[model samples]
Target: MKGWLPFAGGMLAVVLGAVWTLQGLGVLDSGSVMDGVTLWAIVGPIVAVAGVVLIVLAMRARGRR
Candidate 1:
């Protein structure tokens, strides 16, 4: 397999995490309760990092095969 699932999922996570981070930081406006909550500002980066790690693992798996 080419690890397409992980690659795509990671990309999605990166996008969502960035949005959440922006919203939590009040850098972006949104109606959701999570907006400007401050908690997501910290959590968002962690999620983004996890996504990047997932992407890296996916690439490594692809390269191996």
Candidate 2:
């Protein structure tokens, strides 16, 4: 379970990144993904950070057990 956390987070990051990219490219228009600079600037960093955090946690969990 713990080991899977990183995989889950990475998968989430991939999915979100793809969605935003597609939206930006006008291939998928679910919403205005680039309407503001905040979303454009923050989404990638947030996803990356979350994924790294999850990966670190998963690695630490493995070390404990």
Candidate 3:
């Protein structure tokens, strides 16, 4: 169960980041304040990349164990 935590968190982060990115870019508009926001556009990718790193680290740790 411990091993799955980071994977799950990472997946969630990736999905949310993608949504935020799209919304920020105005590509997935939902009438929210975040839509077309440049800050989210920048932040989303960073979050997504962090998530990817987390996933990779988790995988590596599991492999080592």
Candidate 4:
């Protein structure tokens, strides 16, 4: 359904953000270029929050329907 689009995107973003955060914290150990990068520590949470906002908006839209 059209309503699922934003929710799906939000979920994807959350997953990616969590991965980035873990890598930044040197927890996941992917061994990629981003691994153990301090910048992601700040960027990851912001991205996750954006995803949360998207999810919230999707929920609100569903409520209105």
TM-score of predicted model 3? 0.92
lDDT of 4: 0.87
Which pairs of residues have clashing backbones in candidate 2?
Answer: none
Local distance difference test, each candidate: 0.89, 0.64, 0.89, 0.87
Q: Which stretches of candidate 4 lie over 4 Å from their true place?
A: none
**Candidate 2 residue lDDT tens string, 1-65:** 66776767766875676566555555665657473334544565566666667767778878888
What TM-score would candidate 1 get against the native?
0.91
By summed lDDT, which 10 consecutive residues of candidate 1 come out lowest?
1-10
lDDT of 3 by residue, 1-65 (tens): 55588888888889989999999999999999999999999999989988888898788878887
Give candidate 2 regions above 4 Å deviation. 11-38
Deviation in Å, model 2, residue 51 alpha carbon: 0.5
Cα miss at 65, model 4 (Å)? 0.7
RMSD of each: 1.0, 3.9, 0.9, 0.9
